[model samples]
Target chain A: MILRLGADFLVAVLFSLWAGRPGWPGFVIGLAIGFVIVSTSDLAFGRPNHGRRLLWMIHFAGYFLAILIRANLQIAREILTPGFNQTPRIVRYPVQDLDDLQVTVLANCITLTPGTLVVDASEDGRWLYVHCMYAEDRAKAVNGLQKLDDRLRREVFSW
Target chain B: MDTVRDVITVILLGSGLSFMLIGAWGVVRLPDAYHRLHASSKCSTLGLFGMLAGAVVYIGTVDALIKAALTLLFTVVATPVGSHILAKAAHSRGLRQWDHTLSDELADDQRDGPPQV
Candidate 1:
């Protein structure tokens, strides 16, 4: 639980830097607000087993940052190259092994991926409708997405 | 020289801000969250990016240049994220569209295909 609090605090500090939030005062306030948010989640969900959750959160953040870097590189290449890849299609791909927040996280991860955008999801959350700029292998891509979803959504978030 | 840079910066900043302001208006005035997201996500980001770029041009330091590049990169990443989550939430909450949304392709798959598990 203390680890979770510290991890959440780190997240808050990173968020402040990312947001360009003014100064030390702003950073402190940001952490406070983040603390409230984390505490509430703990209260509501009764907190995940302490050590495992910390490990997961660290792993999750690292994985996310790495993926973000990769995605940006692809986008940059696509923009610069201008006519290399084609296979744009919007399709609804089925998903399993997740809940709402995980699904949400999955969908956003898709959106962040350069070649794809998550257009919508099914009413029952059975499928995520994705429009891929280069939709070569939906199965392969979705599998990659599932790996990410499992690591980030399942382990880190305690979802 | 300074005047020229200032004018260019002003134009760039104005263009970006206009995109953002207009997009924000679209968000408020547009009929639905989906379309509004279309406006806000697409336009506002480009706007913000443009504004940031303009500011970067004005500052023209190595640090500022790196920061601007990072900003552009991350905004591209984050905006779509936010939009996707909102769209998913809307879909889950039964927010129907104004028009027939072409066809429910995912729904079709469930009935026709074998069980996926």
Candidate 2:
């Protein structure tokens, strides 16, 4: 944990330098910010394989960016064109295996993606009620969400 | 180099403005609140990011770039969460879906009691 904190501090200092503050004061500030971030995260989530986690985070970010852009374009088309191709409905998605943090991340990802927004979670957190804009075929809509869930489970949370 | 930067900025700003316009139009055009939220949240997020990217590019300063990047990051994390909460509240309060909606599984689940473990 201490090693991770040190590494994070160094990276933060480097970031400060890259951000155009070239001085001892910037380094001190960076170290302070880094300490706060690292400690807070450590408190939230226990120590894990940092290198593997960072790699998966990068992977997730790239995949998420592509989908995010696609979602924007899809909405733009819906707006620019004359009529709507929307078949909105709410579906109950099972979230049985995921813990709280994983569920939160999954919910946010679903909301940000194309045509899906998380409406609520069941009292037990076993299911997420999702509002899907394009649900003409219920199975397909569920399948799309299932795919995202599988990827997140495999890539990010497997550690 | 300067010309390239200017052109990029123009493109970014133009796209961002158009996206914001479309989001506004969608809110006016869509059938219901839920659908409107989709348009407003998604488009505005991309629109804001585009404008921020333009600012970062135009300024070409470390401070400006970092600030813009931080704003983008926060928006990326916050926008969806905010929209989710709003949508959840709307659903719980029985905000109506569009008339043409195909199914209502969530309503069914709510009415039928919680699912079996």
lDDT of each residue in A1-159, candidate 2, tens digit only: 336746776777686777778555676677667766776676678766465666686899899878988888888888888988888888889999889988999998898799998888988899998889989888999999999999998887876
B30 Cα displacement, candidate 1 (Å) = 24
lDDT of 2 at A132: 90
Candidate 1 TM-score, true structure as reference? 0.48
TM-score of 2: 0.83
Docking quality of model 2: it rates as medium
| Model 2 ranges with Cα > 4 A deviation | A1-11, A14-49
Give Cα-based local distance difference scores for all models.
0.64, 0.84
Alpha-carbon shift of residue A32 in model 1 (angstroms): 14
Query: Which pairs of residues collide in candidate 1?
Result: none
- Candidate number with greatest lDDT: 2
